[model samples]
Target: MEKLLTIKDVQEHLQLGRNRVYQLIKIDSFPKIKIGNTYRIPKREYLEWIQNNIGKTVFL
Candidate 1:
């Protein structure tokens, strides 16, 4: 099983602000899951997305 990351984890990982993290989540291709009112990102998928989207702006 893979780890699921919270918005704060993502903010720390990407060195982004809370609003920026939420903005990224709004992008259609971002790897995320919604559980109730909380959002969780799959660690593996996020890592893969990083590798794949290197040098590209992810927020839309």
Candidate 2:
């Protein structure tokens, strides 16, 4: 199975606040899975998102 990352992992990796990570989760394009009350992000897609958004605005 592919490795899944929690919101906390994403926050730590990106050095972002918890709320910011949660905000990203709300974006349809952002890769995520909702299990019960928790959210999981795919590590690979998260990395790709970082790559694709480098030097670009994350929100319009």
Candidate 3:
């Protein structure tokens, strides 16, 4: 099992606004786990996703 991150964590880590993080989450391939009314991002998968998407433009 890996660490799970909150949306706030992602926002702070990426220096992005809450709206931007939410926009990324709306993307089909973004890694996320929805539990009840909240969302958790798998730490490893999030890192991998960033690496994988480098040099690509993401649009919400």
Give the candidate number with the greatest TM-score: 3
At residue 29, candidate 2 shows an lDDT of 85
lDDT of 1 by residue, 1-60 (tens): 999999999999989999999999998888999999999999999999889999986545
Candidate with the larger lDDT of 2 and 3: 3
Candidate 1: stretches off by over 4 Å: none
Tell me the tens digit of each residue's lDDT in model 2 across 1-60: 889999889988989999988888898889998999999988898889889889988872
Q: List the candidate numbers ranked by TM-score, top first.
A: 3, 1, 2
Best by lDDT: 3
Number of residue pairs clashing in candidate 2, backbone atoms closer than 3 angstroms, sequence gap of 3 or more or interchain: 0
Local distance difference test scores for all models: 0.93, 0.88, 0.95
Sort order, lDDT high to low:
3, 1, 2
**Colliding residue pairs in candidate 1:** none
User: After superposition on all CA atoms, how large is the RMSD of candidate 2?
Assistant: 1.3
- TM-score of each candidate structure, all chains considered together: 0.92, 0.89, 0.94
How many residue pairs clash in each candidate at the backbone level? 0, 0, 0
- Model 2's lDDT to the true fold? 0.88
The count of residue-pair clashes in candidate 1 stands at 0
